[model samples]
Target chain A: MFQDFKSDPFMFCIVIGVILFVIAQSLFFLIRAVKRAKALGISNEKIKNTISSSAVFSIAPAISIAVTVLVLSVALGYVLPWIRLSVIGAISYEVPAAENAIEAAGLSSGIGADITDPKIFTAVAWVMSLGCILPLILIPLILKKIQKKVTGAVNKNAKWADIMAAAAFIGLICAFLGRGIAGTGELATNDAGEKINVTIGDGAGILSLAAIVSSILFMLALTLLNKKLQWKWLEAFSMPVAMILSMAVVVLISHFAPGLAAIEWRY
Target chain B: MMKKNRSYIDSVHFYGRIWCLLALCVMLLVPTLMSLHLKAWPDLGIVGKAFAATAVLFYPTAVVEVIAYAPLLGAGGTYLSFLTGNIVNLKLPCALNAMENVKVKANSEEGEVISTISIAASAIVTTLIIAVFVLIFAFNPKFTALMQSDTLAPAFKQVTYSIFGAIAATYFVKHWKLAIFPLAMVSLLLVFFGSIPIGILIFVGVIISLLGAQAMYKLKWV
Candidate 1:
């Protein structure tokens, strides 16, 4: 009765409807925010700058996210991944969640697995949707309380408030940076089934580290150019430009200099 | 201006809640309808096990994120960002850039408005891009092949690192004093202990950085 459900038109229609709903939500907020910005006396130029730069900044990351959708679609079908990635699903979280769901269901866990079985597919959808549901639930319940306390604390000491914000951002950066660095080491299995790693710096870890360094360099160079050339407009595009260029460079290096690329471990 | 701002925020909360609740219902129905149509309800036990595996880790992280990101995102921005997703990677960065460009601080009303504008723009653009790609490329073998091509794999893999690295560099350089201790401590942990979950590391870094900054402030170093 449920055969051909994976690529069914009904499934695609549901996914498309969800996507459109999200788009409408985005537009609602966008129109409201723009009006508020105007009421707040922000210049049209500044508002335009914010919108254009943000739209520019989002392109590379959105493309990367699309790539994720494409990869997941191969296994889960286009409808589910498209809906998942467009909504609360992230690349890092969705892949693992799907694999775990498949494993828990005693199904083969990988892209090549036959996931067309309706029961198996239903289980996956349920698991994936339920897994990330907490944030949606929590945000509505506690966000206002949290914001009130945070705003009160910050308002008490404006100077330290800036420091607090800066520190939080720094902490986030350090976490990502630390992870990138840690990924560079080599791992080996021991007799006790424990994995040991040597810091050889020739894997995805090192490649990621290199990408970070190259992107930073590109940003610094852009900063210098902006200063010397008085090209203020470049400031908005600097981060995205640096990101795209750095990724392009790494891709070229990986293709031409295989040794420089992160080694893919095969079991 | 203050009264106007407060009322606007209140209205945002009112509308935001309704929109999010509706979105949540739509999300739930995706699976519910599929099950009804296919007549294949999943094993509840299996679903529970899978949910536990992911939720145990993610639930706490989600709580932490709302706390960590609310100030930066403000009222309207926070509601929209949480609903639209991609907070750290896309929304936060867009808001940061907008605030920086507009010369507004997050604590100020101006900052809140600018953040909302930027995040809303980002959400719109991201959704449109995804929609276009899904419609245009989902059925095309050539597009799928190109996306999965060996030559482009490294670029895709490094995209997150490059994006975050550039952002980190910009902010770290600006607040080097506040950044040093946390960066050093986190780097040490990574070096010695392999990899720590970002969720935990963020709190560790925040606490250390806050303490360090406070100490420096008391010492009149800034």
Candidate 2:
């Protein structure tokens, strides 16, 4: 008993194109590192530097691109105002009669035409701004901490904290997948084509199914790709493709479900 | 050694000649289709105004990077700005690589290696701070959702997963470094010149980028 959100196809394609370009470019840097390594005579010390540099260099651009695009979109919305229409206008005929009647009555204001309230925009903007910026700053700090712990100044056994953190991340990922799936299930119809009702009760099964499928696919692809191909291109395309496809599916389901973002707007 | 660098120039020429036309075509078609289907086409005046507005907002960092922080002098700051700009909104690779080589002078008796690491770390920190500022105050998912509709969400999702792809691709390719300047320029052109047809501009830019790159290579710029 669930309905899925409809995903926007146009966005999916746009994201795909972006992903391709980023990956393609990153691969270029990797190639450069290799050539540079070769040029330097590929000694043990040089090779190590080359490897680390390549890895770190790639990380910089990928992170930069992602964060930039996300933040820019939000910022532009703020600095520049935009209008979004929610309710569709109703159809009408007898325009001449209506115009004449309205003229006689001197009542010409159109009903049901409402500009979005400034308050809601301000509130949403505030929340969005916070969401975009906070994590960007914090994530790197957290990553640095993790790196420090993993490669300790003093060598020690792997800490329980790291293990717990990994587990938590996995759990969060599962939950996200489950939510997507559960939301999608609500949009599904029965044999009679009646819309299924989604509530807390039926959310578990769909979520579990989606999570299991996603995990299995992720693991299988990782293993297979690692076995067969060099790491760079595989890393560049495979994981992102999976993430985008799943996200697109979930979003599409939501879009088609009229009840999903069914927030009532008052102007 | 010089010959090897020169070969890079030739490769850019070869690649750029073919790809520029394709990019140009795509650039032309995609935006036009988007406008028609979405009924959201902006007239020339509107587009120009919007473009100008965006440029103004970016000008501060641009000026700092391009002028105050000259590539040869204020390399670190310039690079930091370039990286921050990429992470914030636009993906122009303008002076990022050149900034990477900025020398970090440690007051202490630290060696060259230590100094280099310090510089890199400082750059990273600066980049993060810029990104945080952008994200915390400038980002707007709601409007993005409006402009992109629901599709933007999945693209984001794709991006999350694609990190691994970036990592992997960066790890394995040979001579990947040569690709950076061209890639960065292409990304810049695509993001800014939205009016240009992607296929055609790509075709032209790729050609131009390659040719330009080859010329640089021949001149031993690499």
Candidate 3:
């Protein structure tokens, strides 16, 4: 029963249904927003550019998300991960939540660890779903109020508002950068309770750090090229292109310098 | 005319609420239907333990995210983004870039619409891409191997680093005054704490940046 449930056609259909619903919701909003843009006197050309650029910008991240789905599917099965990553599930949140649920159920946690028990599977599913439900619930209940306060504060002073917005974005970006850099040399414990040294100077950590730096450099290069070559079109798709190129760099570096890709210090 | 524009936003909230409520019901149904079909329910005890484990960490961050992201995303974009997820990685960046490209202030009506449109586009594309990828590689062993391969693992692991680095370099160069203090503070906190959740750091960053901006304004530093 457990094995039958893992790759069940019905389960896949349900996941597909959820994805379709999201797509429908997206289309509904897209059409309405485009109409609003038109009513507000935004030109057809600008609107079209926004749509095309956003779609282009999304491809790299979307593929990355697909990688997450593939990662989570090994443990939770394809349907659940597909459903989760598609709707409101961050890879950061899903994996840890799934592991916590598995451990709580008195099961060894990892991919392919006999998670086919119906109760175990159900527990993992519920935990993953319920854990992330707060955002969905809270946003609907309080978003208007939140927006009103935020807009009100910003409206009080135009210059200050501009500064605030820029600051908030900077803060968010800085936090992510800090976290990424900090993780470069952190110690990670595996399921066997062995400590592994993850160093950025000459291991997978280094490759990860190099990807970050390379992406930044790539963006700079794109900026220079856009200026030097007089090609304004490159500006719209530069970030995504840079990101994909950086990932490709990781692949290349790992192939040529395998020792720097990953080195486990078993202790 | 102002009244008409206001009504448009109002109607968006009205419709957004309905859609969000419906999405919630649909999301909840997944677990319910699964349990019924499998004829297996999670033990309440284990469910409680699991929920506590995750909620203790995530709930506060969820609250912070709503507050931090609402102003940037606006109402319509916020609704769709929070519902569809991937706000920080995919949707937020897409919306920001679109708004920047179109030269609209995020506080204005035009900004709101542009944000909504861009987020909607991004959500659609991401959904389509995921659907296509899943269809192609869902059960394929070779594809799975490629995904889990050591050579590719570093690339996948560093995706967030690459993305954030590019974003930071762009924004920091553009807004160095606002960028300097928060970047320093957050980096320090990360060094000290080892692993702070992005939500908490964002909240802290907002407060610090606000203070920093206010100080610079008072000092006539622009």
True contacts kept of each: 0.73, 0.03, 0.73
Which residue pairs clash within candidate 3?
none
Residues B1-222 of candidate 1: C-alpha lDDT, one tens digit per residue: 754566777777778888879888988999999899889999999899988998886888888888889888888888888877878778887788789878898878788888888888888899889877776676677986777676776677667678778887788788888777877887787666654555677678777777887888898765
> Quality of candidate 2's docking, in CAPRI categories?
incorrect
Candidate 2, residues B153-202, lDDT tens digits: the string is: 32333332233232223221322333444444544553444233222333
Best by DockQ: 3
Residue-level lDDT for A215 in candidate 2: 32
C-alpha lDDT of candidate 3 relative to the true structure: 0.79
Per-residue lDDT tens digits of candidate 3, residues B61-93? 888888888889989999899888888988987
* A164-245: candidate 2 lDDT, tens digit per residue: 2222222222222223232222232345534454442223232233323553365356646867876643432343344334
Tens-digit per-residue lDDT, A82-199, candidate 3: 8888899888788778877888998765544557788988888898889988877887789888877777877798888887787777777776766666533434557675546545
CA deviation > 4 Å runs, candidate 3:
A1-3, A110-112, A184-189, A192-204, A263-267, B1-6
Model 2 regions more than 4 Å off: A1-7, A42-48, A51-267, B1-33, B36-39, B56-222
lDDT of 1 at B119: 88
lDDT tens digits, residue span A1-267, model 1: 113577588887787788788878878887888898899899888889888998988988887788878767767877788788888778667877887788788865454455867887888899889887777788789877877787798879888778878887777777767666653333544455455764333233557777889988998888788889988788777888888888888878877876757453211
How far is each candidate from the true structure, as Cα RMSD in Å? Answer: 3.7, 21.4, 3.1
